[model samples]
Target: MLLPMSTAIAQRISLENHLSLETLRSGAGGEHHFNGMCQAACIASLLCEAGYGTAREGLFGEAERVLLDCRRAGIETENWRFDGKSYRILAEVLTLHDKQLSITPVRELIRANERLKTS
Candidate 1:
């Protein structure tokens, strides 16, 4: 059950769970144009951090990859909208890695590092 979360929350979670907003906001593949690109952006971030050049090179390409991988992983993507898919993709990525980080430190890091930029 991937619930739609606020964009603010999604941004924080991305920074905490994976990469920075700068990475997700990349102009690759014209991904920022779509409304359902959050999940793709998160996937792009993950793949980029994992040293995948193609993922770092584009967003929608990564978006397509996410959808495909999700299907292969027995997950669905039709329900994602707005910022909803961000959490869904992030959860899947976490599960793939068998890793977890407390929300507390992430929040603190956001407050200390990212909040000022947004504010």
Candidate 2:
């Protein structure tokens, strides 16, 4: 599977530039599983941003840690089911688990959650 620059390097790449496919996927090999597991991919990207690791190794290991982090941060995750489509799960986890994150990746999710309260 082909992959573009990571969430980290993506900031530097010009969206207007016509990057070659080879350049985009130059270093890709076994670390391209984002399409099937959006949550995992987001978590992996977050972990990398948090100084965990670059390569997406040990999916189960990363998942275990993410769950633990959620629990430690008092985020209720027992009822959470990963359908691999909703990135909101990832956003919620990150938002609640660590309020220190710079990027608000789930602004829409936040608004939706708020709307549910006033409705």
Candidate 3:
């Protein structure tokens, strides 16, 4: 499916400004990392809901990795889920950021989530 031009451009900009591992590691903290992971899972879940299996798989893989990192750092993340499926937030974030997939739906999903939160 073709994404909106503005969304595509925004994705490109995000890719250009992608975060580095060093930056992520340096800023790693309990709440920040957890939030990042949640963001990743939300993105992946959106892509999966939109029928983008390949993108979903990639994002899910990344989320798993991030969760592993959380575990290594002695942070607990045992309750996150997507449609009854358990997920690690950090790994999801990595998967959601994969360059091979477009993140337009992910952005929309996030916005929807925000609306839901406020409503």
Candidate 3, position 8, lDDT: 63
Summarize candidate 2's per-residue lDDT along 45-109 as a digit string, tens digits.
45445544444355435555544443333334333233332233443433332332233344432
- What local lDDT score does residue 69 receive in model 2, on the 0 to 100 scale? 45
* Candidates in order: C-alpha RMSD to true structure: 13.4, 16.9, 7.9
Candidate with the larger lDDT of 2 and 3: 3
Model 1: per-residue Cα lDDT over 1-119, one tens digit each: 12234457655654543432222333222222232234434433443354332322444444556545433333243322223364344444444322222222333333333433453
- Measured by lDDT, the strongest candidate is 3
Candidate 1: residue 29 lDDT (0-100): 20
For each candidate, what TM-score against the reference?
A: 0.21, 0.19, 0.42
Clash count for candidate 1 is 0
Worst 10 residues of 1 by lDDT: 27-36
Per-candidate local distance difference test: 0.37, 0.35, 0.46
In candidate 1, how many Å is residue 44 off?
9.3
